[model samples]
Target: MKATRQLHDLGQSLWLDNITRTLLDDGTLARYIEEDSITGLTSNPSIFDAAISGGDAYDAGIHAKSLMGMQGEALFTELALEDLRRAADLFQPVFESTGHVDGWVSMEVSPLLAADTAGSIAAARHIHHKGRRDNLFVKIPGTPEGVPAIEEAIFLGIPINVTLLFSCAQYEAVSEAYMRGIERRLQAGLDPRVGSVASLFISRWDVASNKQLPDELHNKLGIAVGQQTYRAYRQMLASARWQKLADAGAMPQRLLWASTGTKDPDASDTLYISAFAAPETINTMPEKTLHAFADHGELHGVMDVDGGDADAVLARISAAGVDIDQLALTLQREGAEAFVKSWHHLLDGIAEKARQLAGKSDGAVLK
Candidate 1:
């Protein structure tokens, strides 16, 4: 069997962390669902920026939206929703079969609002409303400011994908927010089955800490972090708080593994995918990583629910002069800033495209 199929059979969801108009128009996304067992997808400013600028696939859409007086975030949202709605439909079967736990496509709110609780909540609602799909998750960063927004959005019953998490603490904070929202909903006589996921980023941990550690410890920090976080995830699900919510028909907000693509060329391309094999969790990989895994990825077994040697590995990493807690905060901040940068680049690219298309229609070449 293909490793992808094997992994899926083991109960870990394999999601493609990418979306582009070309992927949809060329039927690549559908093919992934049918062949590689990809049940979901995710997109952020960086992904959309690359998609919009890398090809002419979005030119006609950009041009059309420009004619309709849409630009910037508004224009991008429309284009993103169009693709997500289509992708959501493609994964509808997996979504239904899994009882709405497997197939989900995520669209992030504007990264500029990462620190604005009100704006994040409003954007999430607006996007979810515009998306018009049940399986769509409006991604909100799990920053301090975003935590309240996450809770509020969940209380409002908006399916949320909490992004930019880097540690077990961060994961716990967001998970608490999700439960609080569900608890609030139950108290207020609302449905408790709001879909959500706490996305814990991997690979970046090793990327940030590898240079400070020895050769033996290189490329190990991320998996260690993942193990530790997964341990917390298991513990949370077993907690009375979660069990009460589960008894009330609330779904456990799943723990998702993001940034699974290996950043170091010296490492195996499928390093993160092979390591993060566990049931009821998700691993969203770059398209290249997805293909590479389907081709040659190996799954030994599921992760250690007790965290294995994660604490030891982390301790060694700390003894090597890395402050794990401080690094987590720094990574979350840096991740937010990086997304903001990509968000700007994405908007600027769209504006430029609109201008170029306008010039062409007027029979003048844009310089």
Candidate 2:
């Protein structure tokens, strides 16, 4: 069986960590849902920036909005919502089938607001309202400043994808923040079943520690970090605190493996997909990795909840002069900055498309 199918059958949801108008219009996303077991999707500024700038897929939306005096973020967010709403419709059945545990599509708030907590909260709330889709998750960075936003967004009944986490500690912090938000809901006599996913970046760890490690340890950093985080995730799930939340009708905030694309050309493309499968967690892959898994991937078994060998491996990497904790901070900062760059590029791309499609609004390029 395809590894993607295997993961789904094992109860680990596989989400495509990408979305483009082309995918939706071309029926590629639909095929993934039917054939590859892709139950959800996620998009960031970088992905949106690439989709808009690298193609003419969004020309009509840009032209229509431009005629309405929208530009910059105001224009881009609306265009993104149009795409997300369509994507959400495609996955709504899966969502209903799974009782809201799967079949989600994520749209991020402006990376420009990563450091602004209140702005992030307000933006998340606004986007949640605009998208008006039950399956939509507002992507928020897991930065220190963004934690309060995550909690507030969750408490206010907004689904969230907690992105930009690069370490086990970061994942746990966001998990705790999620619980706090749910706790608030429970205390206020609200429905405590707010959906959320804490996204842990995988390949970036390997990329960050690659130069500092020996040959054997070159591509191992990402998976090791994932193992450690998965261990923490299991511990949290079975802990007394989490059980209390679960009893209160609060859902567990799934731990998602993100950035699963292999950075090293010589490495196997399925490295991240097959290595990190665990029940109840999620693994969101880029299209290349997802296709590779569907083509020829292997899964020995799901991740060991006890995190076998993760500590030894992480210790070895650390002893090799790789400060993993400090490095996590740096990688997250870089990720946030990169997203900001992509966000600006996305706005610029939309503006350019709006200019080009000023009078030629009779089309759907992605279709």
Residue 346 miss distance in model 2 (angstroms)? 1.1
What is the clash count of model 1?
0
Range of the 10 consecutive residues with the lowest summed lDDT in candidate 2: 358-367
User: Per-residue alpha-carbon lDDT of model 1 for 1-367, expressed as tens digits?
Assistant: 9999998998889999999988998999989999999999999999999999998999999999999999988999999999999999998998999899989999999999988999999999999899999999999999999999999999999999999999999999999999999999999999999999999999999989989899999999999999999999999999998899899899999999999999999999999998999999999999999999999989878899999999999999999999999999999999999999999999999999999998897785433
Off by over 4 Å in 2: 359-367
How high is each candidate's TM-score? Answer: 0.98, 0.96
Q: What overall lDDT, based on C-alpha atoms, would model 1 receive against the true structure?
A: 0.94
Native-to-model Cα distance after best TM-score fit, residue 127 in candidate 1, in Å: 0.4
* Predictions in order: lDDT: 0.94, 0.90
TM-score of 1: 0.98
- Checking candidate 2 for backbone clashes, the offending pairs are none
